[model samples]
Target: MDNEDKKQDIKDDENKEQNIEKEIDNNKISDEDKKNTEKDNIDSSKNTSSKSSLETKERDWFFEPKKDGSPSTVPSDVENVIKNHSTYFLGDTSEKVIYLTFDEGYENGYTGKILDVLKANNIKAAFFVVTPYIKTNKDLIKRMVDEGHLVCNHSVHHPSMAQVALKSKEKFKEEFTGVEEIFKEVTGKEMPKFFRPPMGKYSELSLAYTKELGYKTIFWSFAYNDWNVDKQPDPESAKKRIVDKAHNGAIYLLHAVSKTNTEILDSVIKELKAKGFRFASLEELK
Candidate 1:
């Protein structure tokens, strides 16, 4: 072979070696991509399993599978308990804060408007709701959650929490858990850690049982005789009573069904604001 022929043969050998190296690099890249895909699938599976476990826990503790029934009207003895002794539910804080709560044993057509006023004033509150309210007013409940308000359990049948005799601890638990179940079923969210005993009637036994079930019984410091549809207090007087009682760490109880309450709420907010009190959710006080 001549010199030119020998040089051409050397060039062909170098080009073959370069092609082999390129093929090997591409194979390695393909193997790495396969490994990455497998790892991603594993991560996705683990995430799905973890989410399923969380949902199961939430469902077991907080929601019923189906709606039970309508909530009964507020009982008279329960009203008396509410009228006589609701002072201890007020938290002992010195800040210029007032906690707002609305009872939903029955809807008398004012809850949405009440929620509107609260939204307009940039305030959040706690709504202690029964089963019907949970099942029927899902939109309002959704709004409450979306708007950063708290929804707590009031009881299944709207029985007074305090009026339960010492012997009926199991009954107390049932009512409390029943409402919690409805809230979970409707909203797929856990009920608030706070609770408002129906009619503000909680006995020592009732309170202990609720605590065991993981709840804090919230009571209001300021409330008017607003539940009476027959003798609803005038709006201005109701506003005056609420404004005068506004103070730091005060919990105000107002019925969502009160027309007088709806009319006076704006002025009440203004007066409370003017008095240097700020409205807050129950969680903030905690």
Candidate 2:
């Protein structure tokens, strides 16, 4: 062939290769399947539906599915709507600091020791309590307040906020109001505008309602199976897990009822401090 004819033939070969690549890319899935896949993707991404759209209304809570040594994160669905919406999972990323919070559901006599360790360390923490805990441990609650610690509303009956807050505004209102009244009655000070949903259970609407009620919703960056008073974690291993996961702007959820935590709190604090991690109150984020 002549020079121009050869060039045209090469260009035709390139076009044929490109078409073959397109065909290979479409292998296994027909064009019909591809169209259906695109439609399914779009449908799955629609976040407009409210909680009422579902049949089985289980309160959805976010837990990090993997632990590959980065700071624990929330689901994109949770993060998308609540971004800049006053819901806090961790503190600012400027320093190696941790916020300590305890869910006090009827203290099991170890909260006093936990408080003693915190006092000795001179680190303040946020204590989330229910109304029953209010009447049950008035002195401890006051001490948490008087010691300059934060008292956060954990709801009245300790119900999952996802089940209560958005579902019934009155029930949600009564839940927080009851706890606030008891806290005010005991501590003689208004409770701080901080809320941690019970069992780390929450929904977008629950978060919005809590924010509307003048509170910042709190979730933890790091927590383990420490809620059980009966099945306490081994102190050293628990300490290791906590210290290993230490990162800037971490929030730790520890149950006050765990004797393991009570035994390890002082060491955990010291070890984290040794690793250059300082503790801060949730008020810092608020």
Candidate 3:
């Protein structure tokens, strides 16, 4: 009777050990499955973030009422739409900084004089140009680089900027990369990662598109109808308009195509300086 009881007791101990081993193996498998599920979730989040970056909504950009001695404003709808993306309609309000920008869609023989005026005043500005402008005006683009001025991206073509919202990720990236390639090819220098929408037209999606490409989407606080090469405005009156509308954090957009701008730029600079407003580069906005 004692021997049989001893054998039964041994059998029970072995069964208990086997059950404990099975539980440990099951826990190991469960832990591995949990880690793999967590990894999949993280990868999924990353993919979603990248996809959302390309799928952006659109908003039309419009400058608010700008008057003499008054700071320009941005529309709230536009502002609300683009606030998350890297864009600026105005700079630091506490500083009396004037941002002078020029659009160069094509050469009109006025850029050189404008450069001269800017050089004479010792103020650095941002000049935005399309690909054709860069290809044709390599010397001026080089001059801008050598003189510490920023040559910004205006796009590969002077197309309507509203279409950027409809672009696929590849097409959206192409707009910026296309210009950067040509700019680097033509001037042998890296282009400044700043952009202005063509024809002063843009959508919130376009702003986000540019921001995703490592660019700062710049909009003017003040701009006039200065792009006309033929029917240019009166130089005296134009100068007066530019200066009188000056305010803190002013981003003034002029066109290099305008003969009046080339002629009146010096006076504009002098008058703006006289009014206690200092010209600054776009970088200061950051």
Which candidate number maximizes TM-score? 3
TM-score head-to-head 1 vs 2, winner: 2
lDDT of 2 by residue, 165-229 (tens): 54578887888899999888998889999988888777666777777799998888888988887
- TM-score (all chains, Cα) for each model: 0.66, 0.77, 0.80
lDDT by residue for model 3 (22-132), tens: 999999999999999999999998998765654344444567756557788776766676688788878876877898998888898888888888899999999998888
Error of 2 at 121 (Å): 0.7
Pairs with backbone N, CA or C atoms under 3 Å apart (clashes), candidate 1: 161-201, 162-201, 162-202
Can you rank all candidates by TM-score, best first?
Answer: 3, 2, 1
lDDT of 1 by residue, 1-286 (tens): 9999999999999999999999999999999999999999999999987534321111000111112221112234434333322223444355777888888877788888998999999999889888888888888888888888999888888765655534366876788778778888777898887877666555544555666778776766666789987789988778876776565567778888889998888888988898788887787654
Candidate 2 is scored at a TM of 0.77
Segments in model 2 whose C-alpha atoms lie over 4 Å from true places: 1-59, 65-69
User: How does each model score on lDDT?
Assistant: 0.72, 0.83, 0.82
The residue-level lDDT of candidate 2 at 191 comes to 91
lDDT of 1: 0.72
Q: Could you tell me how far off, in angstroms, the CA of residue 281 lies in candidate 1 after the best superposition?
A: 1.1
Candidates 1 and 3: which is better by lDDT? 3
